[model samples]
Target: MSAAPPTVFGIARLGKRTKDLTKRLQPGDIAIIDHEDIDRVAAEALIERHPAAVLNVSASTSGRYPNAGPRILVDAGILLVDGLGDEVFEGVRDGQTLEVAGGEVLLEGDVIAHGTDQDDVTIAASLEIARAGLSEQLELFAENTMEYMLRERDLLLDGIGAPEVRTVLDGRPALIVVRGYHYKEDLATLRPFLRENRPIIIGVDGGADAVLEAGFRPDMIIGDMDSVSDRALRSGAELVVHAYRDGRAPGAERLEELGLGDEVVLFPASGTSEDIAMLLADEKGASVIVAVGTHGTLEEFLDKGRAGMSSTFLTRLRIGSKLVDAKGVSRLYRQRISTFQLVLLALAGFAALAVALWATPGGQALVQILGARLDALLSWFTLLFSPRATGS
Candidate 1:
């Protein structure tokens, strides 16, 4: 007798990128993606959507580095099928009902694609291999950094074609927020600085939402506008849509459809949104740039599953002196009590002292003396009212 076949059922939603697909994904839907080396952020997003299962056409963990995406999905009890290949996409259409059983993708009782089902053992083994490849990734990162310096040398050395926006950043601090690792915690930590300095707030995509969540509005929002919420777009922040070097602006189209295109600014560049944001601030004459939740280290960039970080490296080189990470700022910034705060403190101290004196022995003696005086006055009134004393 043949063994029974395993079966998992859900509607399939397909996309070449995890981020793009997640926007349309609904609960209990199966996500079909071609994402290679899934990042932690992408995994978190998919988990948030509560998908039934994830089917990847490409390798979820390619042994490039110890990526946590697959582990995250599997640990969350979401079934993950790896290396199903591009054929899976052709076999399954968007919103088509499909069945997955024992690493086989089935379309109406037919096996469309065969893949390896990932579990704890396999994922852990892959992570070990990825850890071994970290050195190679580091070398490649260095090479890419050198190449970026050559390609973007002109822009880095000389501010060429930097867009001029209405937001004045000259000689002031600019807070650039990215919704990357620990952004909420970092934002909370910097609340004091935000209150005191009131730096120009620049939110990169979803970071706009973070700013709004932290009880503040962004002064400028710069990004592709895909991940950002509609609420953030209509936040009255000066919108700067990042365009490609060829002047293709997809974000602009989204803005126009939402009736917000009239006031939007188009900035055509060749770097990531966060990079552009830093350059925008630096070019606008900002004295200092404090970055919150921005990727700074090699591992951080790797976690995003980037082959290279050329633009980020060059952007940092250009604005090295002015740019500082949130951690550094939080550590170095010292809070000083203002004169008004000191005066308030003194007043509070006096009020506390008055309450303490009112509870003391001397305070009770003073009350008794006042009571005796009131009694004598009352006795005098009674005597005056008597018939003998009045000649009634």
Candidate 2:
């Protein structure tokens, strides 16, 4: 006879890439990821998946930087187990039912691995330590930036090798969305900008889905096509596949399989999908580039967990003042109807209404009636107080 199974916390879903793993996650599932220092973007994706718990093979923070991902996970009421090590992966496969209790991972009532069960208190304290060690990280980041500039000086100094996209961006503002840092809130905040400007919308990977969710169709979709949905790909937007500098595009394989081989343009460049999207917009003569959910600060850049982010830093330098992030979107877009403008609009509306009323016989009669009523009220006031409106 088989032994009784231990208390089941959730069903386990395992994968090395947190982004890919999130695609398979359902509510009440336990996500097993190998992501190190999980960035804000990944955490947000995981939170949306509604996982009951997350068991990581690597340290979620590693004191590398004050990454907000771990804190985001804990705050969302999801259980987190840190640094379970590669041994956990050896035994665990995808879709295995497991129990997580008191920092111990149990498979069929047998303890297979142990880890640190992280909560808000633990994550907050680690973030403080990560902030203290940020100086070293900044120095390293500077070095990487210089090194990247040397490698891609042409792309940075001059707009070289940007793809010839079919979308007309000339003199029009471009809004690039990424599935990064507070994207939902940022998108919501840009509703005024959306209604007023009607900027060319560009989505990076899953951001296309986000754009659709926010009630806008992307004018262009740029990414490796891994995380994007087939529905987004078929949404009549121009697709730009990001390729490596060596001209290798693994994402192209998926596109071909979906019978969309002729529907894409390959943009071979280094850096991230977001970086390439900005470059394409800039080269296409966009009046300005507005970014949503992309990394902004030094900490967010490092939290992306790759050396290629140096290209994003340099991409900003390349795009220069034309690039605007979501935090500054409201400031740049104070183009909203000002008090003076509102007064002018109100006056124009009243003038139009008055002209229409005077042009109609019924309206003219109504206006004459109102005028007579006004004169009667004035005469009554004058009679009631003789020389003044009051007895005084």
Candidate 3:
């Protein structure tokens, strides 16, 4: 079969699916770059692998919109066909031959029947539709751009030290810990650090739970009020509500319900839940802020459905060296079994073996009988006092 000129669609799911349409993309395989936002990392990976002409179904063709994927592709010299929407997918499904001239969809049919309504549709037309539906998406992109701008201004904070590690006497560094999906795992690992009071802890909404679970209370909680629990809200942690671009705080309503309006600080930013938390920590002069289970890569940022990690990316730049990603910290602090525990277990095993050997056949029989009696006795004691047994 002859290779079809690859068309990049803006939707990720479709882009991934297009691989099945062609055997092995030699030169003519059209790259359908799907995704409302082009995934820079995915695009780079795809570009490296296929080297095919790209049909960008994404929202942005110009890098001005902060869609890094498109910008990267354009820079990489990949032939990009912009603004072909669901029709592009239909084209492929029906085995249509697509033609692109100067990043414009010139002709979009071969085997597939082209509809009249779609006939006059230019790249601009598709972009207009995307703009209307994805106005929010563009804003998200813009917010990310602003966030990166903010972080760029504060690049000194990008290290692995507590905020007050050196300057203040008896001053512990400030820590911004995350408690998203990996709260338990992050807490389990961060427990010892909390115990040492290394930094002031700030939790990103649910991260407060992580702090408490790590046996510490968060000095601050940041995010829109949705995911935080009642127990977490009433846990006496200071609250910071992340608001939208208009400064209208969605979290403020929940705070009022909990009578915590006064306690709540409104932070209007266009970043993720985790981004606001770091910003709060930085604004408050936190010496060090550590993030856990926070979105770090392109996929993670996209998985959160955020068009850009603009705020997070910016916040990291703002607190550059001081903002330590928790993944890195976990890798640095991953636990190994202690030698003492190993030694103790070894001794216990030897003692158990010694006792087992000492009992001869008749003695072993007697020992077994005694052990059974002891087990029954223990069970009786457990039944009397155990919470489950006592129904208490």
In candidate 3, what are the lDDT values of residues 304-374, reduced to their tens digit?
Answer: 55666666656666667977676655556667889999999999999997687667787678777889999
Q: TM-scores across all candidates?
A: 0.73, 0.77, 0.46
**Candidate 1: TM-score?**
0.73
| Candidate 1 ranges beyond 4 A from true positions | 1-11, 93-101, 106-110, 213-215, 229-231, 246-250, 253-264, 303-305, 327-392
Give the backbone clash total of model 2.
Answer: 0
Order of the predicted models by TM-score, top scorer first? 2, 1, 3
What TM-score does model 3 achieve against the real structure?
Answer: 0.46
Which candidate leads in TM-score? 2
lDDT sort, best first: 1, 2, 3
Best by lDDT: 1
Instruction: Tell me the tens digit of each residue's lDDT in model 2 across 1-392.
Output: 94342333888899999888888899999999999998878888899899889999999998878888888898888888989999889998778899998789999888999988887678888899888877887677788788878877777777777878889999999999998776777798899889999999999999999999999999999999988999999899999999988989999899899888898899888778898899889988999999998876777778766643577878888889999888544455455678999999999999999889999999899999999999999999889887645665
The whole-model C-alpha lDDT of candidate 1 against the native structure comes to 0.87
Judging by TM-score, tell me the better candidate of 2 and 3.
Answer: 2
